[model samples]
Target: MEQLKLAARNARKKTIVPVKQVRIGEGFVVIAGPCSVESEEQMLITARMVKEAGADMLRGGAFKPRTSPYAFQGLGLEGLKILEKAGRETGLPVVTEVVDPRDVTWVCEFADVLQIGTRNMQNFALLKEVGKANKPVLLKRGMYSSLKEWLYSIEYILNAGNPHVILCERGIRTFETYTRNTLDISAVPAMKELTHLPIIVDPSHATGRVSMIESMSLAAVSAGADGLLVEVHFKPEIALSDKDQQLNPRQFKQMMWKLRKLVQFHQQLAKQKSPRGET
Candidate 1:
C-alpha cells in the first residue's frame, strides 16, 4: 500500500484522471458502449446512442479474451478502427481492451484509454506495456484476486510511471452462481480509502443481468464510486457478445436519467460535507 502513495487520496484534493476532454473523478462519469465491436454499423450506432445517453466515454473490446475460443473474438484492428471513427463522430473518447502486450502500441494509436481487462490484471508485462503508453489506463480488478493483490497489480502499472490509472471493480468471483459475479459494492469506498486513483464500477459484468444493472449502478454511485462502465448496445438481443447483460439504448437512456439525478444528489451531499469554499 505504501507503494501507492502517489495514488493515495489526500485530504487536500482528489486525483482526477484526464482522458482526452473528459475529467474523471470530478463528478460521476459514465462510460457506456457495446461489449464488443461487432461491425461498423453496430459500433457507430451504439456510440451515438451512448453519447446521446450522456456517457462521458465509449467502451468496446477490440481484442477479446474469451473463455471459449469458439466465441466471437473481437474484430481485432478492424474493430479499433471502427471504434476510433465512432468516437470521432460522437465526440466521445474511446476506451478499448488490450489483451496482448505486443499490441499495446498498436492499440494506443487508436484508443484514448487503454483497458487492462480483469483477466490481464496480473499480467505484469501487459501492465508494464500499458503503463508506458501515452494513454490513460483503465485497470480492472481480477475476478479472483484479493483487494491487496489487486492493489499490488496496480502498483505494477504505477511503478512503470503511468500516473493516469483508473481502477475498475467489475466484481469478483464467489460461491454464488445466481449472478455471473458478485458485485462488491464495498470495494467502491474501500478503494477510495486505499488509493486516490479514480475507481469506477462495471455493473454490466458485475451482475451479468440487465435487470440488476440499474439498481447496482445507483448503489455504486451512492457508495462513492467515481464513475461507471456500462454495456449499452443499440440492439442487445442480437449483440454479438454478452447479450443478456447489455442494455439496449432505450434502457440505457432510462438508466442514465435516473443516474443523473442520483449523481446530482450525491454531489450535493458531498458538497455539504466538504469545507466551505472548496470545490
Candidate 2:
C-alpha cells in the first residue's frame, strides 16, 4: 500500500463513479462496444444494440494503441465524433480511451469517462492529466503490472484530484498462448479487500476468445466484481482492431440477457444486507 492515500483500502466506505443515470460502483454496470470506432454506421448500430441490451455505458476506442506501428491506429477525432453521436442518440454515457496527456482535455469533450488503457496504465503524465479533468476515469491494469503497482498508478490520478475513478482488470501477461492474456479472476475480490475502488473485468481482452467471454464474464460477476467492460462490434469479423477478441452485437445481447438476471440477483442480495444499499 505504498503511497496509496487515495486508492488505499477502506472497508467502511467505497467509491461510486457516476456516469449519467448509471452509478458504477453502486451496482453492476456494463459498458460494451467496438474496440475502435470504424464508421458512423458501425458505431450507431453497435451503440443501439448495447443500450437495448441493458448496458449502462457505451465504450469505443477512438485512439487505439496498437502493438504494430503500421496497423490501423484509429480514426482519432473522427472516431470521437462518431462515438459521441452514437452515445447521444442512444442516451448511454460515452467511454473512450485517452492515450496522450495532450488528448485528455479535448477527449473529455466527447467522452463521459476517459479510459487509460492497459498499455498506458503507468503513463503518469496521462494519468495526472485525466485526474485533473471533470470526468471520471477508467484505469486498466497493465499486462505486466502487479496489484501494488496498479494501485500506485491510481494514486497518480487520485492525487491529481478526481475521485471518480474505476479499476479494470484486463488480465496479465503470462506464458499461455491460447488466450491473449491470463485473466486474474482473483483480482476482483482482491481489489475489494485492498481498495475501495470499484473494479471490473475485461474478459474480451483477458481471454481473447469469443468462446471464453461468457464464462469469464460470469466468473467475474460471481467473484464480486462491480461490473464488466466488454467488446461488442456489430460485426467483429470486420473490425479494424482486436478482431479475434470482439464479439458481435447479437452475441452481446444474448450475454446481457444472462448477465441482467445474475446482476439482479446480486442487487437483491446486496439490498438484503443493507436497507440503504449503495454498494
lDDT of each: 0.91, 0.91
lDDT of 1 by residue, 96-140 (tens): 999998999999899899999999999999999988989989999
Q: What TM-score would candidate 2 get against the native?
A: 0.95
Clashes of 1: 1
Residue 74, model 2: lDDT of 94
Which pairs of residues collide in candidate 1?
Answer: 7-196
Model 2 per-residue lDDT tens digits across residues 1-279: 656777888644888888898898876889999999999999999899888888899999989899999999999999999999998999999999999888988999998999999999998889889989999999999999999999998899999999889999999999999889999999999888998889999999999999999999988889999999999998888989889889887788889889888878877876685646554
Q: After superposition, how far is residue 220 of candidate 2 from its true place, in Å?
A: 1.0
Runs in model 2 deviating more than 4 A are 268-279
